[model samples]
Target: MATQSPFPFLDGLFERIAQGPRPPDWLVNEAQQRLVLLINHVLMQERAATERLIPRKGRVVRVQWRQFFVALQVTPAGLFDLAAQGGTPDLRFEVTETSPLGLAQAALRGDRPPVRIDGAVDFAGDLQWLADNLRWDIEDDMARVIGDVPAHTIASVARSAAQALRGFVRKSGAAAGGAVAPWSGNGPLP
Candidate 1:
């Protein structure tokens, strides 16, 4: 039950794993990166659920930022030999006393490239789009997984990616721009 990607570009992604005799590092990176994004998404979902929102729509699982960040850290457990390219935390974010404008200027000079977290970020527009596109889908998906089967946010679904995907779907009825965080609902930002 591999979830059908909302974006068609991803269809070829999983299939690439078997095409070459030697698995591509890109494939490994892709899978590992997906896992990392999944980690972040689930963390956010768990938090949202605890806050008693819809409890289940997730759309941010495709970001590559985590790959850039996680590549810097190695697995503490030497069991499956992992790759660590960056420092401990892959994404390096620091609180600064600088003004927003000044901070933006300094961040422009920060190390990015493989460590993609330092890239210029525009949250306002993206948040608005997420609210419109994913809001209802997230809630409905949450109901199916966390509601009926009770899969914990971090767990990889009921079992494999297939089963997990069975519980995931895009809500057709959900309007675009409904994925509102509590802050968007006139609450304080977390």
Candidate 2:
């Protein structure tokens, strides 16, 4: 039996919105700046992440998703600086999935969105290492400003909320006749 989408109207609405006019350049730049700021904050937690990129200083890496793109250059300080000129990229990553719904589903299942890569093998390896090892400890960062006790309590609640949300998503997916792939180990791929 063929299963129908639980929210066909939402699916169509998303498609239409995605096809609509792009945001202004300034807005896009602001969004990119905010994203970079967040990434830098996360990077601050792991000194080794920046240190590994030191040798790649001045190298440009371009990452693209849908119509949004950010070109960043590795600085001598080992952090990323936006390259407004967008000179030739030493490494480029383009997200293959175009549909917002599909990407959201993948994320809910803790799966990585497929990406097309174009870059030096060594740089790519280093990037992969950074991805695999470095993780932002949001609770630890919060504790720095809010004190350990409150931060721990907040983090615990946040974690529980996240787990509940993930469970809801999985159940909704299954009820819709869709399989939610596991992040790792066992379970069939969607």
Candidate 3:
């Protein structure tokens, strides 16, 4: 027998909310710039990551998720900067899933949503390499601001909370006939 989702209400609510008008261009642009800063910070932490992109300098990669998109150009400094013009992208990735809950769940489980690609195979391969190889040390970043001990403590506590949340989701999934596997990289509802 087909079963109903535990989060049917939330699913409907999210779907309705998503139908609303998009954010303003200025807001979107600001958000994209902040995202670029965060990405650049992480890249700077790992020399090898930027080094690999040296040959791909000046190439533009566009990433799209629903109505939002960012076009990045590889800089001579081996980092990413916003693309100057909406010119042809050397590589493009379009995220298939649009549900906010689904994307959040996949992220919690350390999984990537399925994406459709259009453009250079080599550039795509480079991006895949970045995804597979690069990881940011959040605790280390925190340590630079706060002391190492305090940063470690905060990181540990945060990690514990996340683990607890994951455990709760898993148990809820099992108890509800496996419906709430949000962290399992499954559909948001089932």
Q: Give all TM-scores, in the order shown.
A: 0.21, 0.78, 0.81
Q: Give the TM-score of candidate 1.
A: 0.21
Error of 3 at 41 (Å): 0.8
Q: Candidate 3: list runs displaced more than 4 Å.
A: 1-17, 175-178, 181-190
- Runs with alpha carbons beyond 4 Å of true place in candidate 2: 1-17, 175-177, 180-190
lDDT of 2: 0.84
How well does candidate 1 score on lDDT at residue 73?
24
lDDT of 2 by residue, 54-79 (tens): 99888888998887789988889778
Question: What's the best-to-worst order under lDDT?
Answer: 3, 2, 1
Best by TM-score: 3
Question: Over the stretch 62-128, how does candidate 1's per-residue lDDT look in tens digits?
Answer: 2232213233221222111233443233223333322333333233333123322332243223323
**lDDT of each structure?**
0.36, 0.84, 0.86
Residues forming the 10-long window of minimal summed lDDT in candidate 1:
72-81
Residue 58 displacement (Å), model 1: 25
